[model samples]
Target: MTAPIPTVFIGGNHEASNYLRELHYGGWVAKNIYYLGASNIIWFGPLRIGGISGIYKSHDYLKGYYEHAPFQGSASRSIYHVRKYEIEKFKKVNSPIDIFTSHDWPEGIERYGNTEQLLRCKPFFRREIENQELGSLPNRTLLSHLKPNWWFSAHLHVGFDAEIQWHGEGSTPYPPADPSKLPSSVPTYPVQVEKNQDEIVLSDLEDNSTDDDSRLAKKPKIDAGGEITNHNEPGCNIPNKEIPVYPPPSTNFYGDSETTKFLALDKCITNRRFLEIIDIDTGSEETKPHTFYYDPEWLAITKCFSKYMSTAQGPDTIPSNIIDEKNPDELEKAKAWVKDNIKDYRILDNFAMTASGPPPKSCNPSTNLNRFNRPKFNDTYLYRNQQTTKYCQMLGIDDPFTAQCPENDTVSK
Candidate 1:
């Protein structure tokens, strides 16, 4: 049987960590279904899609993936939290992105959309919005760093839209000459700029590739530094590095200053706007309409940094001085390696059931556990799936999540 549509998803706070851990490099979870891994950049036709799975928790953000199944205490919950290792990896991207998704909304995003209406619809969010502490801070940074044409998120459970216009320091987001014509409810946030903070360069995206999608076309050369404002300077300590920063693309398919469209959706339920069909123009560059490939640069970054992954340890293994546009040799070498090693870049719609289904309803052979099973606090066994082994072998990197599970002890978390 064949599925009607293709679906790709990222991890949220709640997921089957035990199973998801197997395809850590992102693989077909099922026929027509793809998991985007911990953090990844995948290509669908002319669209370059990238994202990081998991929500944010400052403590677990830098610890790497150290939790195992039969999770104890808060391990099950904390295991799905976002990590710095993945966040730092995205900072290495130097190409234009078409779409980016995240499980949680970016922090400070409330300022860009109409907060008052959001509060009216979901009043429970008022406290968090008022305290200015809603959404993941790291993801917010990634949003500013990788200014994709379209950004979609799903944590807030609301139908909202906002346009973020990337502008220089002295530029205004909108024309100040006509405040009277602007609707009061147009934004729940104010167009104010942050003052007096150290800035870090995110990308020096210098691509000259010819594509019909103006957003992905050859970008004009500009100054070599772009800055994303840092709000929560406490829990987030962005490393200072020397990377080139360029302004948003001068030409856009929409025919305006380079901007990103942000949308957040609720869960699909009766009378809820959870499902949205977005229409996009792939330009004249798409070879196939229903195919996706690996982003060469992202693959390069992944292969280059795969050795630094921390599956069962503290501290992020990826060095602070990671490769960026300034370091072209390392990236070129990895890209070259990918071309030589990865025979087919296309992501085939194929799935393999490498393991058995969950214990058939509680840990009992008679029945399996429910989504909210009683979490164990001490068992920390790891299962190495054949999918992960092959993925690592192909990438030429050591498999990080290879702890052995006990014999005859077949309980899935």
Candidate 2:
């Protein structure tokens, strides 16, 4: 009986290298091992940096030392050229090469509408959209010539668990042009050809149907119990009142269009000393706002306004008049309301500050701020104060005011 054909998996880049290393170290001693891509050197270079010359040298070393022949190929090169090279390479070693591997989709797969998006040749808004189809490129001259029984490739990050038959003669649905008007490289060859003058039948495998939309539909559903489930379920009619009611639509202030406008406005603010209060918590900070350091309370209000400007601008912008000067109960209520509703503010003090500049020498909290000629409310100072307040709050210490020195007091050397 013929020995079971050895199988191996190969991929591209550093990820493949790490995977191969794990396989090698895990005692997987398969006689056939292949590395297909440009990044193999990234993995093997460190092992034999000065000692080895090329990939063949490393392969030979592995085979001689570890008793496993290593196959290497560059998928970037022409598939036809690589196939020919592989056949010749295997012939010299007198090894029967049964399988082919690559880090790229076969040519026909690239023709699938979805393949264009995989290569980022086009824009894709949602990840769920199938931008290309599978097995659409086998008709290409290079792939057709090589014609491996089972072609293995990745690069798309898609899974085609089921067998995909090649439909070479089918018309492509993209570019929305007539195929007849397209120029052919060469005359199509007849499928019938006698190798030893013995009649052999070649079946036409192309499925010529423009209705490929069905092939691109969502995959069959599987139930939570891991069994195949019917997707057609009867809809249950329930009272509309029983359904959860959603709140009225609210507008986003820092969305793409607004963000762009804000950036431009920030540039103007940077020119003037008018403060720009940024909500640092949301990772949205304007480098320049219209003045010097503004009050944190004002900054919080600005953030809230920016978040729901459309809604805020519509009549109910300001809250009902409520005063709590010395009333402890009202002050506590106001503090809670501010904390819950307001976004924390951060000031962009130095517009052109850099690490290499004459400021922020060390971020150590205990560093003497007086020695650096930095302002009392510099980023470091403010950050340190914030941290102290946070620590005190976490420790259930209600008096954060004691942790902070007078805000206006400058440190004197």
lDDT of each: 0.62, 0.24
Q: What is the Å distance of residue 97 in model 2 from its true position?
A: 8.5
lDDT of 2 at 374: 43
Query: Residue-wise lDDT of candidate 1 within 239-338, one digit each (tens)?
Result: 1111111211111222222777888876544555677788865454324455667666777788888878876646665554563355656656887887
Best candidate (score: lDDT): 1
Poorest stretch of ten by lDDT in candidate 1: 235-244
Off by over 4 Å in 2: 1-7, 15-99, 112-142, 160-413
How do the residues 84-193 of candidate 2 rate in per-residue lDDT, one tens digit apiece? Answer: 11221111111111123454444334333333322231122123234222222211222333332333444332322112233345433222222342232222332232
Candidate 2 yields a Cα-based lDDT of 0.24
Poorly placed runs, candidate 1 (over 4 Å): 167-257, 285-287, 323-325, 358-383, 405-413
